[model samples]
Target chain A: MATPVYSGAARTPQRGRPRDASRDDALRQAALEVMAEVGYRALTMDAVAARARAGKATIYRRWESKLDLVIDTCTQLAQQNLTEPDTGSLAGDLREFLSAFAAFLSGPIGKAAQALVGELPHEPELASAFRETFLTAQRGVLRRILERAEERGELRQDAPRGMAVEIAGAALIYRLMLTGDPLDLPFVDRVVDQVLVPLVAKGQ
Target chain B: MATPVYSGAARTPQRGRPRDASRDDALRQAALEVMAEVGYRALTMDAVAARARAGKATIYRRWESKLDLVIDTCTQLAQQNLTEPDTGSLAGDLREFLSAFAAFLSGPIGKAAQALVGELPHEPELASAFRETFLTAQRGVLRRILERAEERGELRQDAPRGMAVEIAGAALIYRLMLTGDPLDLPFVDRVVDQVLVPLVAKGQ
Candidate 1:
């Protein structure tokens, strides 16, 4: 399995000029488009470069292999615009977090994610990248929300906090990958009001 | 793209003698082993037949194609030994249902199911089979549990019944596929006591 190198996290000394953010975004977007069209199996550097209107050498310069490129794209997809919201109340915080999550599930990132699910078991590097980036970030968001609720004295002290993250992550991902249901606000509200509220709220 | 042929559900008239139950089980088990070893993309009927110590002709007499065989294997894996339990109380029912589900996730079927997750997006017929067979059956089990709770007056009438099932299914599958955590009785108890119990209890 290949070790994925995030742009800034590489141990090697930084080269001359810093990589362009816009160029990286365009490359990742191109990779996502090609992945959504042909899936992870058929994706290639040439195809991604052609789609991005860049030379193939440009892709190799950043990512060591196709696996490296896909992992980076997945990491970017999960981390882009992901920030913990400070919505005062537990319900408010949950609503903000889940709404953003639902948006991710309803867009191109979600489609690309669907194609990656089957590959996880076969690809150790990809699986670890997913856990380190997407899964960890998701848990971190929910954990902060619960922490704020705890500080506000709005959550039960004995609440199973880890399970709370598991439920939220599972419900959304399951719907996206397995059920093929619409990941809309109504569904997000169902997760928030129906489950998260009852499970975490200090008093019912 | 081939439609899966479940026994006794085939549109074509009964052909000759009824298929042997033991024979079918062997083939499905063989398919699962090969899938777990090589994944869905590389799985072939020849490998399955060779593993089962059966001729290719015997395999074809049942499944029309490789997709057909894999789908049937998935359906069988999910449906095997799955039955609704009447544990009477809501929490008891949930514990039993989740324990059985946890058991499935901890076994060989779980490994095979993991590989199938990625293929679902690319294969329409397989996706529908999953929804109709596995997903529907999962919902049906939870629905019956909730209905029984309603009869016993243990559940809130306005409770979000569907989200309960989604949470149960999602949490377990997410843990198995993404987190690579242990799906034990302790985990099952956490789901029951923490989320499902609070989410569904009438007066919680």
Candidate 2:
């Protein structure tokens, strides 16, 4: 399994002429587009290279394989403008978080993710990369939000943060993948109001 | 896409000596074994026929395609014996349910399910069959249990039964598929006590 190189931990910044930032952006975008169009199974390094108009060596220079590239692309795509919404209460934060999450899942990333889950078992390296790059990062965001709620006495201390996040996130994915249901705003609100808030809310 | 054949909802039971029940059982078992050895993607009608020591036509006679065979096999295998544990409370029923669910997800069914999820997006027929056979049936069991709890004045009137079931089931699957974590008894208990019970329990 290819371990994630870009942990949030401080790394000594590479001391050299910076690689072409625009080229990197282009390659990542190309990768996401290909993944969205054809699933992870059919996505190939050569196609990404062709789409990005870059040499295979250029992609290989950064990522070890297609899995690595796909993982990195998904991570980049996922990190677009995550703002923690504060509605002055846990209910407010949950609503915003769930709503944003539903939007993303309905968008390109979600489609790609639904495609990736099945492939994970067969491709351990890709699975590890996905866990490290996307799952861990997303969990971190949810954890921070939950921590804020906890500090405000909105969430019960006894509630398990990890389990809560999994339930909230997985509910959305299950609906999308199994039921072919749209994760609309009303659905998100209902999930937050009726499911998550009550489970984690501090007082009875 | 193979359309499910239903000879009307009220088809009279065929009045004949029950056709080779043991043969049907053997074929289903054979399908599961092949799925475990090779994944769902690699599993084929020819392979299943060879493994079961039956002709391809014989297997196809019962099931229209690999999807039908596999879906039927999964449905048979996932026949969970969920006896409602009456520890005199909702928490007890939830705990028992979670424990049993976690055990199944950790077993062969979990591996098959992971493979199925991967296949679901690309194969619409298989996805639809999976929903009707396994996912829907499982949800029904959980729903009935929750409804029983609600009737006993143990649950909120507007508690999201479907959402709660999805979350509970997905938490187990997410851990197994993404994290490679063991779904031990304590984990099940935590999910029940912390997530499920609270979400459904009566009163704020």
Candidate 3:
């Protein structure tokens, strides 16, 4: 399993009583649910507080703005959901990782992630935070998987390792964000066997 | 050149003084420019009219709402930009097609497309129009390219042809939306040689 790398390292110093971990998690989860349902434009701190059964002041105390809360929520979600699979072969590892990824995209965080992509070009701060935390962590999972395959000599030395990682999960994302297609296991397997396997695994 | 497939076939019947072709084109171009600058959420019919130097009534006479206007704008953009390349080989076809595609994504319509992606899930009308018009037309171009390769005996009989089209342009979309990276020829070439070639071209 991939370890959670984000530890709130960039968070501003808290001024009040120490933050409650459980409450923070609940608020973040609620924020994601709201975002998944209504999208970022309609999301507000009041809605998040209402969904979390917490006070608006409580949310303000922890995060400066709704965008901050969302960034924190997505970062936490990435840390929790990302896992490294050692399935011994490149194809096996890709299958495992992509299946898990497909399932993640089918959930609330996945929908919320789509909600964020449209705004990234406009919101530089959120864009940087997303790339730095969630995207970096997700890429690291695939990078390690590819590196292990290279070590086993199951991949060509000149294999497009970086591009493979980028392309691997892209089908599911393209489906989710663009086509609005359901992400299924069969589709995941096809991408693994037909796309990732051919592109990265040694000796086509 | 890929023929302009969309000819406003889906546009609602206009019920005013005969619409001006040059004026409508100006309105759509203005809509794209405003969207690229302010994003979908901030776009307004009045703003589009102002940018196009047309009256608000002129804008509404052509389209029912701002969303309707955007949908029309994107459809026109797709028709104007998509070109089918005949380079006698899949690699050459993809290279030409992708370079044109990369250039398209670097412009105003490209920015508007990203702005719309965030709202696709929330707006079923826009989603269906996007899928039916812009997305379908794009897939058709790639599908033709792959089918040509198959006919020439360059691709395996069962070479994941549909998946090839899906995966081929995914890296560019991934970078433009997720990573906030610059899309350049070198990156485009890397995707072609490193990923697309190995995935689709027979015998690696």
Q: Taking the candidates in order, what DockQ does each have?
A: 0.70, 0.56, 0.70
In order, candidate lDDTs are 0.78, 0.71, 0.79
lDDT of 3 at A68: 80
CA lDDT, candidate 1, residue B64: 79
lDDT of 3 at A80: 73
Candidate 2 lDDT tens digits, A1-204: 112223431111233556676787798888877876677878988999999999998887767678767776676556553445666677777777778778877876666777777678767877877777777777776776688788887877676677768777777776767677778998888777777776677665
lDDT of 2 by residue, B83-187 (tens): 434455678767776787688777766666677776677678778777776677667657867877877898887776777887777777767766667888988
Q: Rank all candidate structures by their TM-score, best first, as comma-separated numbers.
A: 3, 1, 2
For residue A95, what is the lDDT in candidate 3?
Answer: 85
Q: After superposition, how far is residue B47 of candidate 3 from its true place, in Å?
A: 3.2
- The native-contact fractions of the candidates, in order shown, are 0.84, 0.68, 0.74
Off by over 4 Å in 3: A1-18, B1-9, B12-19
Could you tell me the lDDT of residue B5 within candidate 1? 22
Candidate number with greatest TM-score: 3
Q: Tens digit of lDDT per residue, candidate 1, span A14-93?
A: 44768887998899999999988887878899999999999998888888788778877766666564546786899988
Kindly report the docking quality category of candidate 3: medium
lDDT of 2 at B58: 80
DockQ score of candidate 2? 0.56
Q: List TM-scores for all candidates, in order.
A: 0.89, 0.85, 0.91
